[model samples]
Target: MAIGRAKIKSVGAAQSPLLGAAMFTPAVLYILLLVAGPFFLAIFYAFSDARIGNTEMHYVGLENFRSILKSPSFRIAIRNSFIFTICSQIVVIVGANILAIALEKTFRGRGFIRFLILLPWVAPIALGAIGWKWILDSIYSVISWVLVALHFYKPFNAPMWLGEPHLAIASVLLVHSWRLMPFSTVILLAGRTAIPKDIPEAAAVDGAGFWRTQFQIIIPMMRPILSVAVLFGLIFTFTDMTVVYILTAGGPFDSTQTLPSLAFAMGIQGSDLAAGAAISLFLVPLLIIIAYFMLRVAHRAEVN
Candidate 1:
């Protein structure tokens, strides 16, 4: 009986590695098929003259890249992409910090308020953008209607939220900020709660005021969490096209054209696949750098 049990134990141990491999196989296949495959294909398409109707492609080297670089719209798209991403991140981080702090305190209706705040992040992007588009429409805008009713401006001369270039850019920025703020807020809130209650109480005992405690102690402690939030926000905002496409369509003379939107316009909409691919390739290097730093921060946080 003892010898039989020993043999069974050996068989079980031998199956362990095979079992682990079986569990991991699906994830590896998923990444290869969906992530790596598309990435390498994009690189191939970017290098070749791949048009929508073309049955064959020829290697054009850097021609597509050069053509996009010389285009004025491409330059504008790059500029606007940076502007929207940076500005929206700043807004999201600051606003999220504030919201997180406020939500940390117990108050009446706190749960309901959190639900309302999270609605934007939970809802589909297309739906949110479409809602904002109607809200900011020139003639039927609720904001303009309210202003006109209060005699802020003439009915016919109401401010055009999406009609003017600066306004359109601002509108797009607002939508981006709105969509991302709740997600960052949740991240920050989790960070804040993860902190031991003793730290802040000890700071209070030392006569540290709210601002001093927050800026000096709380913020520094939450650095890793903040890095994760900011990096994720940057990637999401940088790569997003649905919001821009639905809200402004990069309109008002292309004042709000972002890299992703321009890529869609040139590649899919314009039928110049190679040019579109080239435009999208610009995003890869920046994203990879951000992802590397994010992983580093996460590792450090885990170690500490």
Candidate 2:
């Protein structure tokens, strides 16, 4: 047995660098061709005066960022993006955690219920957001009709969900939260189920109440899983413009504009490639910082 184990270890240790490189070459090429390639292009464009359909790019240091800083639209985009991400995640994490716990226990129709929960994540974002657009529309909205039928408001006074500033933000936030919850619940559910039944059973024997077991024992163990889910959710909400675009198009009067939407408008619609690239790149530093700390926390949890 010892000799066999030694042979296995030696075989693994004998893996050549060239063989390793050959095995990993595809992934390296893929990243370079897809991810790193576009990123470097964006950086290059950010420092130059470039525009759509213009081959000529003049060297302009910080000019694009300077213009973006001076734009009120950019300022609003920054505020809205942060508010949207933070608010949606706060609601999603708590709601998803509860749903995950509920779904963990066996029950009738559970398989069907889980399928329903997974629908949004499986559905394309554009399709889901477009469906939401119709739902939020003033003329043909099912929600508005339902509320009116319930005597919540007269037809003329029904809330214009996509028209008012605060209402528009809230509406989009709800859509994002709904779309994100399924993924969060699935991940958290996995985390919850990974805990040995013996641990919770022992806690129960120790007279731990439901709340005590959840808060003290279960939550502490689920920290790493929660961190991963939150990080992904944060990045998704922060970078997503499809919901805002389809629902409100950053209206009424750009009140719902997020950084991604704003960048698209400036870069594609407004035809200022440099400014758009600069606006989008603003997220890089912030996302990097967030990913670093979250990963550190995850590593610490893993160690414990």
lDDT of each: 0.94, 0.92
lDDT of 1 by residue, 1-304 (tens): 9999999889978997898799999999999999999888889999999999889999999999999999999999999999999999999999999999999999999999999999999999999999999999998899999999999999879989999999999999999999999999999999999999999999999999999999999999999899999999999999999989998888878788999999999899999999998999999988999989988998998898
TM-score of each: 0.93, 0.90
What lDDT does model 1 reach? 0.94
lDDT for each residue of candidate 2 in 228-267, tens digit (9 for 90 to 100): 8999999999999999999998998889999999999999
Q: List where candidate 2 sits over 4 angstroms from the true fold.
A: 1-19, 297-304
Error of 2 at 250 (Å): 1.6
Q: Which candidate has the highest lDDT of all?
A: 1
Worst 10 residues of 2 by lDDT: 11-20
Off by over 4 Å in 1: 1-12, 16-18
